[model samples]
Target: MAEITAAAVKELRERSGAGMMDCKKALAENGGDTEAAMDWLRTKGLAAAAKKSSRTAAEGLVGVAVAGTKGVAVEVNSQTDFVAKNEIFQSFVRDVTALAMDVNDIDALKGATMPQGGSVEDVLTANIATIGENQVLRRMKRIEVAQGAVIPYVHNAAAPGMGKIGVLVALESDAGVDVLEPLGKQLAQHVAAAFPLALDETGLDQDILERERAIATEKAAESGKPADIIAKMVEGSVKKFAKENALLSQPIVHDGKTPVADVVAKAAKDAGASIKLVDYVRFQLGEGIEKEESDFAAEVAAAAGISKG
Candidate 1:
């Protein structure tokens, strides 16, 4: 058996960002070979990441890219915000946004050619190897307007547009690009900050409405009012919920008084064009993931190699 020295373990630890004991174990398992130890660490990271796949990854980057009338928004997740700051990771996000403009589907984006001399999958694999961590291209959406423009907004950071959230809005009109593009971009930024649930009330999720109605009905029943009055209360509550949740029904973020739909209309009037907000896409990282609660006592006990007292 080859001897595993402290120096060898430390070197491997620096390369992998893994614990010292983990590096030592990898070196010991791989006959004290640095190259083999590196591979071992990478395999461990991949396994650890797989375990974390079901965990909420709310801290990641929302990236956007635009070319003329076409724009794309993508959300890429990482286990930690620190990884989001890595230059290679940021570059991967930038390229993924550009790829999104060309491919409408996630699978297509995965199979698309990567500029650094391989397919997207190949590049991802190489990045995992180089970064000593596992990464994924989570989801993407693309929008384009043949007549007007698809403007993009990324809030928080820029590796050419990687941030905490991203938005894309498509404006369809006969207006010239100079007049329409600026307005479209401003609206996109507004959408990012506002985080609207739907483009309009029509698109609001029925499940949410049902849930809201149930809550409202329970609250109204407690009032001991007549059945007709209770029904009216529930209906009124639902309307209020829908207006608050829906994108267009919500008051404009910019003015804090006008609805977003009205804001767009006013912009169209100023530009002297009949503009319509056909569609919009917003991606925020880690919105739905149920973050597992950590048991601090158990963790401390394990670290100390002692049974819980």
Candidate 2:
């Protein structure tokens, strides 16, 4: 048996696009022959992942998990919505979300160890091989509050805590968890429904605001008004834009009339606690990812090695 160096495995993986472990095993089995290892990977169908790797995986669950004052949201995307319904996929998302509670970002979460005895990336690779689709751990966010609660909510959940949309709302206060949990949940749900861009008008993205301002200016110019009037129109439009996109200024989803800031104030007063909505995170599955459109029949023909008519 020939010695299989790390470089050999790396080369094989690069050539075959197979998982690290698989590449290692292939190299070992082939006595460190790179071409043979590639053949082995192809024979085992593991090479299929490489072909599918470029496919857009925009459908999967957005999972949320909360641990005491900390909460995390994760989005795991797959090539098709059907994979989101799979029990194995759901379990993976649930476990990954739980694992995310301890990690600060997507890179750390990917490097974190899964409960099932592998690194998150390793397990994800195994899932892609077994599940027969390209899957990606797209993004994650963590929110924590020192005194209040970090609440989680899932919208259109395929399973508890796993869904197409996941939200985390962090409230800061000296209030009891019992009092804060329900309020946090309501706020989380509102986040999922309203899709606020920021916690307040001040937090809104400057680029986004500028884009809105430009659109408002264009509209105002079309009004055939005086320069001062157009300036006022643009300012008013920008203000309305801020209010609509800011969580604190937006109307609460439940009442449709009360501003979120007022609702939080009222909730705090009713509980006799000073609750402050601090931060929030909302992950909507496939929100920004662009899915590839392909010809199904041509894809089948190509996969079958048949020439097009």
lDDT of candidates 1 onward, in order:
0.76, 0.84
On lDDT, the leading prediction is 2
TM-score computed on alpha carbons, candidate 1: 0.77
Q: Which residue pairs collide in model 1, if any?
A: 58-286
Candidate 2 least-lDDT 10 residues: 48-57
Off-target runs (Cα >4 Å) in candidate 2 are: 1-57, 297-309
Q: In candidate 1, what are the lDDT values of residues 165-214, reduced to their tens digit?
A: 77888888888888777877778777776667788888988976776677
lDDT of 1: 0.76
* Residue-level lDDT tens digits of model 2 in 1-309: 999877668666776778999999998898888755665675566763121122232889999898888889999999899999999999999999999888888999999998989999999999999999999999998989888888888888899999888899999998888888888888888888788888999998897777667657766687789999999998997898788889999898998999999988998899898999999998888875766657899999999999898
Clashes of each: 1, 0
